[model samples]
Target: MKIAICCRKGSFSDYWLTYCEENGISYKKVDAYQSDIMKQIEDCDAFMWHFSHLDYKDKVFAKQLLYSIEASGKPVFPNFKTVWHFDDKLGQKYLFESIKAPLVTSYAFYTKQEALLWANKASFPKVFKLRGGAGSTNVKLVDTRKEAVSLISRAFSRGFSAYDPLASLKDRWRDYRSGKCPFFVLLKSFFRLFIVSSAIKLLPLEKGYVYFQDFIPNNDTDTRIVVIGDKIIGERRGVRNGDFRASGSHILLPDASKVDMRCVQLAYNVSQKLGLQIGVFDFVHDKDNPLLVEVSYGTDPDYTECEGYWNEKLQFTSAPINLPKMIIESFIQNSSN
Candidate 1:
C-alpha cells in the first residue's frame, strides 16, 4: 500500500518522511494546496497531513480535503472523528456535551444582548476564550461584570483580531525572561506587533459571539494527555507566572509519577468512544476529578520528554515511541485492513 503525505517543514511530515524511508514504506509527497491535489493522491491508498490551526490556508480547506478523501474510502491520519472539533472550542463544547464527556462547564452566546444578559447574571472571574486559537492565544480572564460587558460590546462591534500582536509580544517576552526562548525570538515578536500576519489577514474576525468557561481555581498546573492509537503519553504544565494559562507556558514536567492515571484512562476511554485514532486532551481538576478543557489532534511534539507511555490497559511501559510514526502506521494498517 502507498500513502500520500502533504509535506510541511517543521510539521509531523518531517518525521513521517523519515519513517517511510527507513521502513521502506511506499509513499509520495503531494501539495494539499494544489488545485488538483485529489488527482495527485489518486495513486495512494491512504493520505496524511499534519494540517495546523495556525495556518490560514490549511484552515480554509484541510478539513474539506480530508473529509472528501475519507468519504472516498481512503484512510486519513486524522479522520473526521479526530479533527472535527480541532481548534474550535465552541464545537468542542457541543461535542463533549453530546458525548457526555467530562468537559469543563462552558457557555456560548451568539447575540450581544444574550451575552450581556448572561454576563450580568453569571459569576465573575470566568475564563473568556475565542472559538478558535490554540496554546491559550485567544484566552483571557474576565474578572468583573464591567470587563465582561466591555468584551461583549467589542465582540459585537469591531470584533477581535484572529491574532493579537500585543499578546504575542507579551508571551514572547515572558518566554525570554524565563529562559525558555532566545532573545532574538523576543525581538521578532516586537516587530510582529507592527505587522499583520498573513494568516490573520486571510482569516475572518471573531465576532457575533462570546464564549466563557467557569474558572476552576487553585490549580497551578494542568495535564495534557496525548492518545495515539493504544499508546498514551502525558505531562503536567505549570501555569505561567502571574498568569492562569498553563498551555504554551513552556513549563512541562514529564514525570510519569506526577501523571494521574485517571486522566490516562479518561483520555483512552474518550478516544475509544469517539472512534478517534489520535487525541490530545487537556485536563484540569475540579477537586480530584479531571475535566477536559479542550481536545485537539495536534501539539508541539518537542514540548515534552516522556519517560514512557501507558498502554490501553493503563499499564506503564518503558519505551520510546515516535508519535508521527504511530499515526502513519495506524493509517497504513487501517488501509490494509
Candidate 2:
C-alpha cells in the first residue's frame, strides 16, 4: 500500500516525508503540478498533497484533481468534504449555516444594488472579507455605513487586488516591532509595493460579491483549534495591537488551561460530521459563546507550543502533537474502514 505524496516546501509534506521514513511507511513522492500527475499516482494506493490557497496554480486545479482521484476509488488525504471549501469564506457561510453551527452572523451580496441596500441597513463595524485569502490578506473592518458603501462600490467596480501592499507593509512593520521578523525582512516588504508577484498577477481581482460578518466586540484574542481524528490541539492568538484580526498575529498563548473545551468539542463534532481528515477552526466569542469564524483543512503545520491533545471525551494527554503523522494515520485508517 504505497502512498503518493506531493512535497511542497514549507507545507506539511516535509513532516509527512519524515514520518513515513522513520516509521517505514510505504510512500512515493509525486508532483501534483506536473501534467502526468494522475499517471504518476496510478500505482499508489493513496494520494496526499498539501495544496495551498496562496498558490494560484493550486487554487485553480488542486481540488479538481483531488476530487477526481478520490472518485476513482483511491483514498486521498483531504477528500471532497474536507477541501471543497478550503479557502472560500463565502462557501463557509453557507456550509456553517446549513449545519446549524454557531458561525458568526455573515451576509453576502452578489450585485452592487443588493450589496448597497444591505450596507445601508446593516450595523456598523462589520468585518469585511474576500472569499479567498488566509492570514487576513483581503480582510477589512467596515466601521461605518459610508465605508461599507465605498467598499461595495469598489467591489462591483474595479474590484480588489488579491495582494494589498500597504496592508502587507503594516503587517511586516508589526512583526518587526514584535521582534518576530528581522529588520531586513521588514525592508523586503517595501519591494512588494513596487513589484507584484507573478502568481498574484495571474489571480483575477476579487469582485462582484461583498461579504461581511457581524463584528463581535471586546475580544482581544481568538482561539485556533486543530483536530485530526479524535486528537485535538489548540492555541489562543492575541490580536495585533490596535487591530481586530488575530489569525496571523503571531502572538500565541499555548496554555491548555485557557482553552475553552466547548469550542474544542464543537470543532471535533463539526469535523466528524463533515468527514474531514484534518480540520483547523478559528473561533471568537460572541458574549461568551464561541462562534466559528472560519475553517480550513490545511494550516501552518507548526504547533510547537501545543502542550498535547484532547480526546473526544475532552480528556487531555501530555504527548507531543505531530499533526502530519496523525493526519496520514487517520487517512489510512478511514480508507481501510
Candidate 3:
C-alpha cells in the first residue's frame, strides 16, 4: 500500500519515513503546505502528519486538509476522533464532560458580561489557560478576583498571545537554573529575546473566550499516559520548584512505579469510549483522587518516553516501544483492512 507521510523536517515524520524505508513499506514524503497537496496523495492509501499547535498556518489548515482527505474515504493518522480537540482546551473540557470522563472541573465565558459576572463571584486560585498551546505555556494561576476580572477584560478586548515572550523567557531561565537545561541552552534564550522566529511573530493573539479550571492543589506532578491503539505508555512530570503546574515541568523520567494504576485503567477506558486511536491524557490529583487535567494528540517530548508500555488488558510490558511507528502503522493497517 502506498502512503504519504507529511514530512515536517526532524519531526515524527522523519522517523516514520525511515521506518517505512527500513521495512520496505511503500511511501512518499509530501509537503502538506503545497496547494496541490490533495493531488499529491491521490495514489496514497493513507496520510500521516503530526501537525502542531504553534504554527498559525498549520492551525488554520492542517485539519482542513486531513478532514478533506478523510471525506474521500482515505485513512488519516489522527483520523477524526483522535484529533478533533487537538490544542483546544475548551473543546476538551466539553468533550470530557459529554463523555462523562473524569476531567478537571473547568468553566469558559465568551461574553464580557458573562465572564465578569463569573469572575466576580468565582473562587480564586483557578488555572487560567488560553484554548491553544502545549507545555503549560498558556497556563497560569489566577489567585484573586481582581486578577481574574482583569483577565476577562483582556479576553474580550485585544486578547492574549498564544506565545508569551516574557513567560517563555522565565521558563527558559527556570529550566536552566534547575539544571534541566545546559549553559548553552540558557544562551539560546538570550538570543531568542532579540531574534524571535517567524512562527512566533506570525501567530495572532488568542481571544474570543476565556477558560479556567479549579486549581487542584498539592499536586507536585502530573502524570501523562499515552494510548496508541490498544497499547499505552506512561510517565510522571515533577512540577517546577514551588510551582503547582506540572504539565510542562521538564523533569520527567519514565518510572512505572510513580504512576497510579487507576489512571492507566481510566485512560484506557476514556480513550476506548471516545473511539480514540491515539492520545496522551494528563492527570493530576488532590489528596484523595486523581483528576484529568488535559488531553492532546502529541506531546513535545513523547519520544523521550522510550520506556514501558501496557496493553489493553492492563498487562505491563517493560520493553522499549516505538510509538511513532505504532501511530503510522495504525493508519496503514486501518486503510488496508
Instruction: State the lDDT at 328 in candidate 2.
Output: 81
Off by over 4 Å in 3: 301-306
lDDT of 3 by residue, 192-310 (tens): 87888988888988888999999898877788888877888888888899677777677785788878888999999999998887889999887868889888886652455647788
Arrange candidates by TM-score, descending: 2, 1, 3
State which candidate, 1 or 3, has the greater TM-score: 1
Top candidate when judged by lDDT against the true structure: 2
- Write one digit per residue (lDDT tens) for candidate 1, span 1-337: 7989999999999999999999999999999999999899999988999999888888889998999999999888789998988999999999999989999999999999898889879998999999999889999998999999999999999999888989989998988888998988998889888887666799889998999999998889999999987889988999989899999898888888999999999999999999988899999999988999999998775533788888898889887757777777777776687
lDDT per residue (tens digit) for residues 1-337 in model 2: 7899999998889988998899898999999989999899989999999988888898789999999999999999789999999989999999999999999999999999999888878879999999988888888988999999999999999999888889989998998898887888788898989988898798878998999999999899999999998899988999988889898888999999899899999999999899888889999998889999999987888887789999998999988877777888887788778
* Whole-structure CA lDDT of model 3: 0.84
- Considering only N, C-alpha and C atoms within 3 Å, which residue pairs clash in candidate 3? none
- In model 2, state the lDDT of residue 266: 96
The candidates, ranked best first by lDDT, are 2, 1, 3
Pitting candidate 2 against candidate 3, the one with the higher TM-score is 2
The lDDT for every candidate, in the order shown, is 0.89, 0.90, 0.84
